[model samples]
Target chain A: MNGFGYLRPDSVHEAAEAYAAHPGARFLAGGTNLVDLLKLGVERPSTLIDIGRLPLDSVQELSDGGLRVGATVRNSDLAADPRVRDRYPALSQALLAGASAQLRNAATTGGNLLQRTRCPYFQDLDKPCNKREPGSGCGARDGVHRDHAVLGHSPQCIATHPSDMAVALAALDAQVELYSTAGTRRLPVADFYRLPGEHPERDTWIRPGELITGVRLPAATAGAPSAYRKARDRASYAFALASVAVVLRIQDGVVDQVGIAFGGLAHRPWRARHTELALLGAPATPAAFEGAVALELAHAEPLRDNAYKVPLARNLALDVLNRLAPAPAPA
Target chain B: MTSAPQPGHHSEVTLRVNGKPHTLRVDHRRVLLDLLREELDLTGSKKGCDHGQCGACTVLVDGRRLNSCLLLAVALDGSEITTVEGLGGDGDEPHPLQRAFLDRDAFQCGYCTPGQLCSALGMLAEAAAGHPSHVTGPTAPSGRPVPLDRSEIRERMSGNLCRCGAYPRIVEAIEDVIP
Candidate 1:
C-alpha cells in the first residue's frame, strides 16, 4: 500500500475544503472497499480524509415519519434499527444479505453506496479494463463474462453494481443528501448512479469534493409489504448473481402500489418503472406478474455467458412478488 | 492543493488492546492486523487472505467484530480493541466459549480458531442485542432477541470458515455456550 497523508477533519466544511484542495484525495469511511482497492493498486490517492469518527453516525426519525440515516451509520446498526426493520424490511433484509457480519459491522451506509464494482478484471491491475483505464480494452468482454451486466451496459464496460443496499434504496425511492463547499443538495437514488456508458470510470454522479451526508426515505414507501430475494452461488458471503427488491401493496386482489428494482444485473440498480406501471391497478395474479416482468425484461441485452441472468432475475422477482402478494380467499 | 504528507513517514498512534494501552510510531499504511501480530507480538490473530474475503483476522473493535486486515492501525486512534488473547480470564481460567470449544473438539488445524472464537463472541453479543440474522423468522420482531437454534447459530457464524469442515462440532460448541 502506498503511504499518504491522513486527515481527520472535525467538520464537513473542513473535510470538503481539504478534498477540494487535494484533487487526488479520497474519503475514507469504514475502509472496507477503499483499503482493498489501495492494496490492489487500483486506487492510489495522495491523501485519505478519515470520516469514520465524524458526527454523522445517527439514524434520526424525520419529521414526516420517514428516516434520515446518517452517512456513517454502520450496516449492522441500520439493519437492526427498529424503525428500519418494521417500516423498511426490504432495506434491512438487503443489508443483512450483503457481505458478512464482520464487514457489515464496519461498513457505513455512505461507503456502501460509493462501493466500486467487483469485476475480477477491474480489480486485476495487469488486466486491461476500460473502467480502470480510459483507453485500455475490457478483458471481461470476452473473458469470464459470466457475472457481467445484462442491462444498461455498453461496449466499454459491462460491470454490474455489487450493492444489495443500493438496490433496496432505489426501490424505496430514497434521496441522497450531499454536502460540499458550494452547499447542500439532494438527488434521487435512481439518478445518483450512472450507467456504464462511454465513461465507465465514473461510477456515480457525485462530483469531486462532494460528500454524502445522509439518505432520506419518504414515508409513503414505508410499511409496505416488501421483500428482498437474492440468488448466489453460495448461501452466504457472496455477491448476488441476481437479486430483486420489491414493495407491493395489493387491495381487493388488485395491485394498488408497487416499487421494484433489480441488482447484479446492470451498471446501476435497475429500477422497474415500466413493470411498476404495468402492475398499477393490475390484478394480483401470476399471469399479471409474469406479463409485467416479461415486459420489463424485454429491454435487457444479455452478454454471452450472462444470458442465464435473465431467467434468474425473473424467477427472483416472481418469488418476491408472490411472497408480497395478498393471499387469495380460501375456497 | 495543500502539500501532501511525504511517503515513508511514520505516524504516532495510541491503541488500547485487551485492557492495555500502547503507543507506537508506525507507518501510515500499517494495518491493525500487522500491528497486533508484529509490533505488539500478539500473534493470536492469524492472517489468512489478508483481504476481507476471509474472516481469520476478525477482532472486536469497541464490542463490534470487524476484519482487522481491512482496518489501519492509525485509523483506530483511541478505540478499544479486543483480540482472541483477551477472551479467557486471568491465570488458567479459560473463557466459557473456549472451554466449550475444547469440550466439543471444534477445531483440527486451529489456524482459524482464534478468529472463530472472537467472531462467535461478537455474534452472541449481537444476537443478545436483538440483531436478527437471515435465517431468523420473518415474524420475529425487531429489537427482540430470538431463540438461538442450530440454524441461527450456523447462519450467524457463517462468516468464519473452517476449511477442515469442522462445522458440526463448531455448531455444537457454540450451541453449548449460548445461554
Candidate 2:
C-alpha cells in the first residue's frame, strides 16, 4: 500500500521498456501474490508496471505439438483446460493443488513461476534473512528450519521454492519464453530459477526489463501417465511438506521413459535426473523405486531441523513412481 | 516546500457497483469495504478480517466472487459488480438462497451473513460448472450433484469465517438450495 508510480503498458515490449526506464519497476500480473507482498512491505517497487492489459492471456497450440501458455493465463483456467489435463495430468494436478479458488482464479502463470520464497524468515522483516537482505545473516540456518531446504543449499540461504506448478513443469522440461527491449529468448524451466549460492536476492534469471511472455511445453505421447502428489501438513490450502511429479511411459513391461521432479525439498524444482538414470532399465517394483530414490536423496544436505525431509521426499517419490506401473496384459 | 497531499480524499474514482456507476473519490488507504459502506452507502458487504483471509467482504465481479476488502476502489474502475442487495427474484423479491437462509435461521450474530450469502451463490455456480472442491478428484468430470455434502460445503466455504458458530444451520441453508 505504499505510494508508488503506476504505468499500464499496452504491449509486452512496451512493458519491458518501461521497466528498464525505471529502477525497481515490477510487472504486475494478477496481483494475487505481488500485492500481498507489497502490503507486507516485503517488496517496495518504485514503479508498478501494470501488464494486465497486455495481450498475454491466450493459450495457444504451438506448431511443434506443444502448448504456449501466455503469462497472464489464470491458474484456474489453466487447470480447467482440457488439453493440459488430458496431455499433462501432472500440470493439472499441480495447478489444482495450489491456493484457494479465489487465488487460483487470480494467480497468473508467469507470476506463479517467479513468486518469492515463502520462508517465514524471509516474510518477516524483523528477522535476518539472507534471501531478503543479502549479507545481513541467515537466521534460518540455526533457527526454526522446519520448512527450509534439503537440497541445493549454500552457506548463505536455505529456502524452498514454494511453487507446485513449477515442480511439474520441471519434470515436463517446459521452456519459459520471455521478452525484453533487446529481443526474445526461451529459457528451460530448470535454468529459470536460480539458487541462493552467493546472492540469494536474485531469485530467477530474468534480466532487467525482461517480462515472461509465456511458457511452452513439448507434447509427450498420448498415453504418458503423469501425476503430481503433494504431502502437506493438512489436506487443502497448505504448502507442501514434500511432493513429487512423475511422468512414466512404460511399454512391454519395461520403462521406456521417465521424468521425476521434487518440490518442497530444494531451492528450486529439484529435477531427479539421477533417479531417472537409476530407474531407466530397472524393474518396475516398489523395491526398484526404493533403490532409485536413494540416488536422488543421496545429495540431500538437511538442516538442523529439516533432516526428516530427506526420507519424506524419498518415500514420496517412490510412492509416486510405484503408482505409475503399467497393468499386466490379459492372460 | 509544501506538505504532501493526503491520499484517500480524492474525488476522481468512477466505480460501477452492482450495475450502477458512481463518481466518487475516496481515501487512497480506505478499503473497498469502507467505500461501499461509508462513501456510497451500500452496506450489505461486511468486513470481518481486513486481510484477505475472511470472506465477509465477498462480492461478485462480472459474476466471479472475490474478497472486495482486498480489492482497491480505484482498481475496480469499470468492472460490473454484484452485492447481496443486488441479487433477488423479479424485482424486489429475494433470491431462493436468500429465502432459504431466512427460513432456516442460518445466521446468529449476522455480521458475516452478507459474505456467506454471496459466497453460497457463487459456490452454487461452481458446483453447476463441475468445479471440484478439495474433496473432489481429477478422475471424474465436474458435475454430479457436487454432492452438496457436509465436507464439500465446508471445504468450498472455508474462505468465509463465521465466528458465531452458526455453521450447522448455514450448511442446512446451502443444502436447501441444491438444484
Winning model by TM-score:
1
lDDT per residue (tens digit) for residues A195-226 in model 1: 98999999999988999999998885533678
**In candidate 2, which residue pairs get closer than 3 Å at backbone N, Cα or C atoms, i.e. clash?**
B8-B26, B8-B27, B8-B28, B130-B142
Which candidate wins on lDDT?
1
Regions more than 4 Å wrong, model 2: B1-12, B25-31, B89-93, B142-150, B163-168
What is each candidate's DockQ, to 2 decimals? 0.54, 0.28
lDDT of 2 at A140: 87
TM-score of each: 0.97, 0.91
Tell me the tens digit of each residue's lDDT in model 2 across A26-113: 8887776676676677887777787875898989998899999999998877877778877888898898787766667667899999
Looking at model 2 chain A, report the run of 10 residues with the lowest lDDT sum.
A1-10
Q: What is candidate 2's lDDT per residue for B51-132, written digit by digit as tens?
A: 5667898887777777777665655656777888888733888888889999999988898998998888888887777666
